[model samples]
Target: MTAVHVTPTEGVDQPTVLPASRRDVVLSYIALTKPRIIELLLLTTVPVMFLAAQDVPPLWLVVATVVGGTLSAGSANALNCVVDADIDQLMRRTSRRPLPRHQVSTNGALYFGLALGVVSTVWLWTLVNPLSAMLALAANVFYVIGYTMILKRRTTQNIVWGGAAGCFPALIGWTAVTNELAWAPVVLFMVVFFWTPPHFWALAMRYREDYAAASVPMLPSVASSDEVSRQIVIYSWVMVATSLLLWPYTGWFYPAMAITLGIIFLIEAYDLRSRARDTEDLSIIKPMRLFHFSNAYLALLFVAAAIDPFVK
Candidate 1:
């Protein structure tokens, strides 16, 4: 990632700068939002809208929701960078973020985050509905406050509960189309909720030292390999079980896909656990295998959900 040289502003006594291009500055701000994470969140969003509408929803609404959701989630992630900037500099994995690298100023990022939040709220309220807007806003608050501010450094179970913030996209998509909540989206919500710990713990396992160095209490950072694997297995099973709850709501294709993906996810989880049990070497215990697989599992499962409505 390239960084831009910044001159000292009126408020800042000393400003840091990195040599970067114009495109780099734009990309740096984009990175602040954690765009890849937003992709996963939006994946859960559009499909639930499909399941909620029982067909293809309005394209304009889809576009609007996507834009609004993007802004809302981006705001949360950028603010998270602001809040975690101190420890972010300590963690190798996060040391290159705009804030830590000085690609974007602290005050600039803070203002950017707040501006995105306000715009997202009003955009959703006007174009989508108040319910969807409120849900998106609530997710932002939970992520920025509950997850980043309060729970993250304080508890080992941080992602376990903080993960709930990620689940709201399911509800937001459903309400975007139907303007109401329903059981189908609720089931999807629980799937993501349960899926969070195992999914995130896998990444944490891979970056254990970085997390430990930063003093963040991510489960894998604080717990023994056995304990972390145990929790991963537990959460994996719960996620798979919650996925099956969609059986009644979705058609045959969805259940079939769900069952198959669930098995794959479980297999990956079991493999991680098996490797951890058999080996003491952290290098041999490749948790990222599960991490990458979990990403595919979610993308495929949600895409299947969207496709199932048409086939069924």
Candidate 2:
């Protein structure tokens, strides 16, 4: 294949030539999937499967669910890249993504994403269960059509509600085990639902100018620092409380981990709120401290949940 040079367009600050190398093309397609975000989604997934089984789930079942979930998540993220391509070029944080960098054509990414969605549905229905497949498909549709197309640019509460799409992995994981829903998975789902805003708002706080430039209405971009931090504290408190609701399903070990992790998460949230209350300076607010800690908090909490059954 020959290298393709794309002319710089409006909203795109730099023109980039697509490399002809097969490896680069493959990697560009992978980048369209936003693999890091998929990792976080999967972290919530596999643990729930373990919790549902209350033992090691069949290795093959675990592998099949992971593969299906990856493809489903990749489809959603890739389509999001396609839809957000124009604004992505305007935002410094997203300018390097494959769509904005001209590494993948819009139509190419769109078709690839659609294809992944189809394959994931079929794969999950055949290998995991029909219910898991349906849940995964719903999540893809919600993330792309509901969140990316509808809510993201229109409202400051985009992440708060749109983040529900991300919460489906917990449901998918649970359904993949029992072919149905339960209060346990529902609680975990809400934990992730509440966790999403504070986690994303913190990152948005750091990239407020990026979202503002992109004309996206992320809360942190449009709201006052005090308002954003206050919202974070509020959501953080709710997320921690929701997490403890799982204590009824798990043993004492899980609650101990949940309480300790929740306390730390709350401290970081309150600290961010405290700093924001003191001043408007982004440098002093340090929202990313809470942002990074939130990642660790979610991962460790889920791991503890997965371990609780065995220890009990």
Candidate 3:
């Protein structure tokens, strides 16, 4: 006699899986928020707050700003994931993102994003102030729906104009501490705004093919590497020059740090230029190294500003 075995999945209309499925879903939800970028974004704000306060900010206020900013940024990223899901599917770098990987449902991601945005707004308004809350809200709207969706697909100048999205955090942090905007924080805001293009175009040069494949119109993809390289160098110089101006508002510590960091940024851009001029496959080693260092450099430069307030 022969016996027939029935498949468990065959009997059920909806599939059942082990516990890992649920855990993965939870993890996917978190990844949809792009935590690394949020961390870097939050880091930009802290030093500004410390400097604006002329020392360190209040402990409770610092905590509130960080938490509120993170939530708003995370919410923006989630919405970004939702809107850019199509382009994201094409880019190797973005292929693993939550929506692209089908790890998070688009509707679920959108709803979660809106909910986080609401919570962040409420929290910041209550704890920080209405102005700080407004700044964060504007940033979220600008980054996710504005840059990632509208401008990113439309033009190479996207990041340049879109740079304003990231600048708001400095404003938010400044207002969080001072409760008013000033020339000093405005300078900080412009520093980050100008820094955005070169920092990103460096990465874009490295990922030109990915941007091309996705039709994402990164500056490097739209321009010859030489043009991209030149722009990167120009922006790096401007960032360093602007950074030096902060010395008048702060002190010797900032100017000193500015020189050291500026030279390094110039050297990195020069290397990128030389490599792009010489290489066929578009050597990214130089740009990749610059991109990595630029992250630390900007944060450290800003940190120096905060410390300068107390420097003896």
Candidate 4:
């Protein structure tokens, strides 16, 4: 394959050309937004609106929730990239991202993130409900300011607390439907809270060197794999317990799905933890699989809740 090279200006020795196969500047920009993570968060949000309200929320409401939440999440991820770009440039996984690759300027990222954030908040407020709008704003702040900026470098537990930023979608979507906060959504929030660490740390395990090089202090870089694996198991068990709590609140069908999925997650966690006696890279491969599956598990459980009204 021929490389597309970007030549630097007069003062710079070499110019950098971004990946050439991609077109659609908009798509590149969107890719910078980390759409998969946003989609997972949104997946948690939308179905809960239906579950909490016992039917599909208004079509306008759902559309508003999706568009607005996505924008907010996109903005948050973009800003995170901007803030961490220096460190990101050192990581093999993230080095190719727009910011790290020098394909997008910091100023451009900042302006785009803020523009998208404002538009998202406005759309949610105008079309969905004020509470969801507020929630979106909070999620953005929690991530960009609270988690990424402040806590990430300070503690190995960064993801543990930082993950809270991602949980607001459940509350936002629920309030969009019910117009008030309630315990059921709170339960869902707790579920995600417990789920984040093991999921993220599993990936971090593969990239510990990158994190160490970046001085990011993520769990895998900061803690022993044994410790991380232990935490994974503990959190996985707690996550399962949390899922069981939703039985009375969300509905029976959701509880069943939750229990079933939770058990599967626990087994995966156990496998990850048990294999940590030795650092055989191959042993923990399944943990990554679990991390990916956990995202789907959470989404499917929420979808079950959404459909529970008819069955009940």
Q: Give the top-scoring candidate (lDDT).
A: 2
**Candidate 4 on 121-153: residue-level lDDT in tens?**
999889888888998999899999899889998
Q: Candidate 2 on 1-312: residue-level lDDT in tens?
A: 122233333554565759589999999999999999999999999999999999999999999999999999999999998888877777778888888778888889999999999999999999999999999999999999899999999999899889999999999999999999999999999999999999999999999988887789999888899999999999999999999999889999899999999999999998999999968788999988999999999999999989999995
lDDT of 1 by residue, 1-312 (tens): 122233322322233467379898899899999998999999999988888888889999999999999999999999999988877777767777788778888788988899999999999999999999999999999999999899998999899999999999999999999899989899999999999999999999988977887778888888888889989999999999999999988889999999999999999899899889856567888998999999999989999999998894
Q: Which residue ranges in model 4 land beyond 4 Å of their true spot?
A: 1-15, 18-24, 280-286
Query: What would the TM-scores of all predictions be?
Result: 0.93, 0.96, 0.91, 0.91
The window of 10 residues in a row where model 2 has the poorest summed lDDT is: 1-10
The CA lDDT of each predicted structure is 0.89, 0.91, 0.82, 0.80
Cα displacement (angstroms), candidate 3, residue 101, comes to 1.4
Tens digits of lDDT, candidate 3, 1-312: 011122222222222222258888888889988889888888789989988999878999999999999999989888888777776666667766776555667788889899999999999999999999999999998987678767988988999988788889889999999889988888878889888988898888777877887678898888888788888888888888887777779878888998998899888888887777755465444677778988988888888888988997
Model 4 TM-score (2 dp): 0.91
Q: Model 4 misses residue 83 by how many Å?
A: 0.4
What is the Cα-based TM-score of model 3?
A: 0.91
Sort the candidates on lDDT, descending order. Answer: 2, 1, 3, 4
lDDT head-to-head 1 vs 3, winner: 1
lDDT of 1: 0.89
